[model samples]
Target chain A: MPELLSDAFEQVQRDVDAAFDAFLPVPQDTRARLVEAMRYAVIGGGKRVRPLLVCATAKLFGVDRDAAVAAGCAVEAIHAYSLIHDDLPCMDDDDLRHGKPTLHKVYDEATAVLAGDCLHALAFDILTMPGTSSDPFVRAELVATLARASGHEGMAGGQMMDIVSDEEEYDLRQVTRLQQLKTGALLAASVEMGAVLGKVPPEGRTHLRAYARDIGLAFQIADDLLDVEGDEAKAGKALRKDEGQGKQTFVTLMGRDKARAQAKMLVDQAGEHLASYGNDAQVLVELAHFVVKRDH
Target chain B: MPELLSDAFEQVQRDVDAAFDAFLPVPQDTRARLVEAMRYAVIGGGKRVRPLLVCATAKLFGVDRDAAVAAGCAVEAIHAYSLIHDDLPCMDDDDLRHGKPTLHKVYDEATAVLAGDCLHALAFDILTMPGTSSDPFVRAELVATLARASGHEGMAGGQMMDIVSDEEEYDLRQVTRLQQLKTGALLAASVEMGAVLGKVPPEGRTHLRAYARDIGLAFQIADDLLDVEGDEAKAGKALRKDEGQGKQTFVTLMGRDKARAQAKMLVDQAGEHLASYGNDAQVLVELAHFVVKRDH
Candidate 1:
């Protein structure tokens, strides 16, 4: 059954990659560098955990495949854009991503900036396009959710906090809030968009939203744990970066054993949020466990 | 009357400023710096020319004043965000904007970058919100147009060309193309969004679009001339920036007299594009003439 879950994840990942490719082809002319950097950053990479949540949730509701794929790719675009910006010299200053030179290093800093900017625009562009949904209301909902998740009250706000968080100390509660805004917003939006695509009633989405929040917190704790214990080669990026950068991640504040226990407990609780759906929620339950279990 | 046009411009500027203030208030906590930077970048500055275009065009179709103002604010957000990024140390490295210290100089590089980024997201956030338009179709159209005009093929792509055009050496046609994308896209979108909000039929938009394109080009040409001959106090920023930077501009390449003549001719042609609408487009016509004749 775990193997079957792996199979489902891979299928969604491949489908999402195809969607990215179809929407974004490498430009052969003047704007090629920005286009190529965007394609390079988005394609052929990472765990695609957000896309999996979107696709799995959509499947539970029998939403159209194309709608699910479009939503998945929109979330993935936001994730990729954030990574590119995070790698900038003025930001995290990292030079490696997925074991390759970061976008700013591979391309010039200016191109890196524009590529990230364009990709952010592209996420909304893809979601609102006709392929995503026939109804404009649905498209607006997707656009609104994605924009809210990606913007000041969400990921960017979290990043601002992290920039200053290094200089000023914060308590566990503050750190948790930062993590929720920085990481949880997009993760929650991925599941939220799936329900949107499925036309889930406003009142009907409570369980799914609860499920997303639990796994989102668990996902961050898992990332913190992996940073401390993961193999660099398997992670496809730097590991154990918190201490070097003065970042007070969950592992640093809570210790590895406690963080690990907390992640597992959250995953179990996330699975329980789907009690109303019973067997229909099996993939989501597996995903909750997989989120904490995965090394990368 | 030119005097009447000037009075109308001030009116819309005040209204747009009020809209921006409503959407972006200064935050009080950890993220205060970013929110402050956004407010500073957006408020109390510029000619408010782009917002004028949105309001004037909407006036032609009698589009709701609130919708027009919302769309105007969205385009202004894109403009403010672009100015912030352009003033980055890696880009234009500007020290002054609107006679005030630039965002990066005021609040460090990282905060400036994120503030600009968040403002970009805030534009989409505002456009898709309920207050922007009651019809979701109108909201989606506004979002799609703004995203396209702001992203790779539009402002950002134009910016990428501007960064390298100094080294690569482009002709007048290339420069015009770059300026169209870099500066023209958002201006054109302002008018287009006004029409969209008014729900103009596809064919009905042709003249408005042609008018927008003509004025957009004229606006850039006027800007080039201002960089050569504008008063520092009136312009509220550095003048002669093009010459000090050694970049070839319309004034530099074509000579001031010729560029001035070209701008005047464009303004006339822009007015002619509104011939079908006659008196209804008087504001747009006056704005075109102002583009060529204004001191700043």
Candidate 2:
């Protein structure tokens, strides 16, 4: 990994951890348990990939670092809440995430549900705060983008497709479409929101959009590969369950070698989209490479 | 019921149904089930009380009817989503709502969870749309207000209290604090957001806030009375569950007749807060009276 990208990831992790810690203070009341569950779900976990994407993209246009990190926190909150609900008994029924017991395993299922819900609301609340951006237009746009990406037409819709995948046989195209909505939408929103914070007009974001799209697909293909062959200890959660369920994925459809090649090709293409930004785009370029190459 | 208040409720129900129908369209994909569940939860159910409150308050300041309805739809989305999750097997464990099977009972638990999440996101999505407000500040404020009301410190926190009430012996004051967060927050937010849409400054909303607070408490007291004495067929849900669980409620803490008298007193107080608006506040006053008087 490049030093710049590694340092950026460390910075994002620190900032996001601090932000969530300050945002959620366990009240001295019966509601304390709910807040604790929410804190457990969000703090000190994951790679902070979404935050890194937001900061990296925002940096290109010289957006404020704090504002970028705030937006990243909002995106990560959505991601964290989705994971909580997805790990429930009715969904993946997983007991481990980030190498710890999933929320429902640690707390009851009811707490897990409420914590996820509270985190979901907290995402929009964070974006609307003046700390995110002084301009109301920027804040409103961020909320709109994140809301659209996380809702019926985006992550939740893709999750529905995944649930039905057990009973239905899907082709590569179908799987791709499903993953696109399930994962790609939020990834794209991260970059788009960064651009919005920088006041970049819609017409000026074609290359950034293309870059996000390429990396989003590459990221998923790599994930499918990881599930098929990665070490469970390093992955920090259950792997190989995708195959056990007989779910079709990029790895199952394209073979490991082809999927690896495709991801590498996509990463390369993603880097090409940032060519006009010169040296300022170096971190983003390295982040794309890391997306496919990371062990986790 | 007064004709003015009854007519307002009818108008709100029709407009909110139409708005949700237009906002959510089932796609020709596996996502159709999720969308269907979302539509089912939002349309053709409940009293549309929140929407009526929004339109009524917005009318006080002469805000645009279409824009007021759009904001009302956003609030209704949040209310509907909360009911879906609250009815889940892991939460209240109910099988019925609004005279129909709960989302989990009709579909599946995973579908219900996803549907609730999608609607939660859709609430913010609707608020950010051009149809809700032309001004960016209003849109941002709407998101902020709704998000705060629905999240950890408000509705979710109240729910956490309710869940623990089964094990804890809560006094009247504790129960009031719990209900204030659980039910009062969202109801108050309905009136606040309506005032926000009409550009009523926060200082100008003191009387309106008082009115919301009074009616919010009155509404819950009435709910408790209904649980003790109302018809299950009319309520469209299981009654007497509070006593079944040995939970302390307004009726249990304040006795049935005293609770009924208190609700009526609060309703009258709520009407007094609207006296400054004269005829314009007539429907709101009637709505407050209806809050404690309705059988369901």
Candidate 3:
């Protein structure tokens, strides 16, 4: 990775962490157990790739940095909450995340559930906070956009499909549809929300959407690649479990070599969507490449 | 109940059910399993009291009935999601609700979690839908209000407290705070969202808030009283379980006679908040009384 791009990623990660730490309920609050669980899951963890996308996209249109961070944190909170829930015994039942005990393991199952639930609600609250924007209409747009991405036909719907995938055989199209819902939706929303924060008009949004859509798929393929042959220490998770589960993955169907080539193609294609923005969108162009190249 | 009040309550119930039927994802969708779980949990259960409260309060300010119903369903969706999560084996772990099998029992635990999470996201989606309001600010307020009521300081927080409640003894103030968060928050938001839809001014909101606050306690006490005294067939779930769990409840903390009396007093006090509205609020006043009177 280039120094400048790597530095930008670290900076956004720090910003998002600070935003999360500052916004979370006080440690001494009455419901501190759940709040503590929320903080544990969200802060000091993850790649912050989603927040980087928000920050990078918002930068393209000169949105205020703090407002963008607030928006970034909102998306990251949802991402974190989804991870916490997804790792539940009933779901993925993973024991570790970001190199630490998962929320349920650290705090018990009930706290984990409430922590995830509360964090989901807190994401909307953070977006609507005065710091995000002076205009409620803009906040409403963010809420509507994020909620749609997170709800049925989006992230949650996709998760359901993934669960059912364990029972059914799915062709490439079905797999793509499942991938689009399970992971792509929120990835798209992160970029879309940044555009919303920037007050970018409808036509301008299409460009960002196009960019998000490509990167989202590429990101997933990269994930599959990681699962097939990732260093668990670097990734902070159990890898190769997809193959162990006897599930079809990019590597399973298209072979690792082909999947790697496809991811590169997607990263390159994603960059084209940002062509009209030129110099203003350099960070986003860098991010598209980063998504496929990240070790974790 | 008065004849007119009973008829109004039935109308609200029907309106909420019809609204839910219209908004839920189609049963034939690719990921219909989760969506189907959401529909089963929401459409065929509860007294729709939260929705009715929203409709009744919005009617006070002459808001459009359908728009009010949209807001009503938004709160109901949140309520439904909370119930689904609360019934998880890690949480309340009940097998029945509203005379039907709980979601996790009917559909797998994973489906229940996703359905609950998805329904939660859908609540915000419905509030922002064009059908809810033409005003973006109102939609934003609705989003903010519902999110706040559902987050750490609200329903989710309350759920956490309930889980923790088993570990430690609680006094009156602690118990009051717990009840306020677990149950009071959403009930309060139901009325508050309706006021937002009706475009009621801040001062007018105070009265509605006062009514909600009083009724919130009364409602919980009524539930406790039902557990101790009411029929299981009509209530549609286990009763006296709070006692079995040795958890502190209004009944345990205050004693049944005192708890029952306090509930009646709260209902009467709730009615006092609406005195200024005269005949326009007659239904709300009667509804307050009915809450304490209902068997289920």
Maximum-DockQ candidate: 2
Give residue B112's error in model 3 in angstroms. 0.2
lDDT (Cα, tens digit) per residue for candidate 2, span B1-296: 88898999999999999999999998999999999999999999999889899999999999999999999999999999999999998999998788898899999999999999999999999999988999999999999999999999899899999999998999999999999999999999999999999999999999999999999999999999999898988888888999999999999999998998999999999999999999999989999999998987
Candidates ranked by lDDT: 2, 3, 1
lDDT of 1 by residue, B48-103 (tens): 88888988898888888888888899899889988988888878888888888899
Q: What is model 1's DockQ versus the real complex?
A: 0.77
lDDT of 3 by residue, A1-296 (tens): 77767898889989988888888856454588888888898888898888888888888878999998998888888898899999999999999899898999998888888889988999999988888998888899999989999988799998888888878888777777888888899999999988898898878698889999999999999999999788999999888898778887777878989999999999999999889999788888988998898888
Using TM-score as the measure, the top candidate is 2
Write down the worst ten-residue block by lDDT for model 3 chain A: A21-30
lDDT of 1 by residue, A1-296 (tens): 39868898889878988888887776544676778878888888867889888888988899898889888998998899889888888888888888888999888788888888898889888887988999999999999998899888899988898889878788888889989989999999999999998899779999999999999899999988888889988777888788788888898899999999999899988999999888888888999999898866
* Alpha-carbon TM-score of each model against the true structure: 0.96, 0.99, 0.98
Report the C-alpha displacement of residue A292, candidate 2, in angstroms: 0.9
Regions of model 3 farther than 4 Å from truth: A27-30, B27-29
DockQ score, prediction 3: 0.84
Clashing pairs in 3: none
Instruction: Please compute DockQ, using alpha carbons, for every candidate against the native two-chain complex.
Output: 0.77, 0.96, 0.84
- Candidates arranged by TM-score, highest first: 2, 3, 1
**Per-residue error at B31 for model 3, in Å?**
0.5
Per-residue lDDT of model 3, residues B125-211, tens digit only: 998998899998899989999999999979998888888887879888888889998999999999998899999877879989999
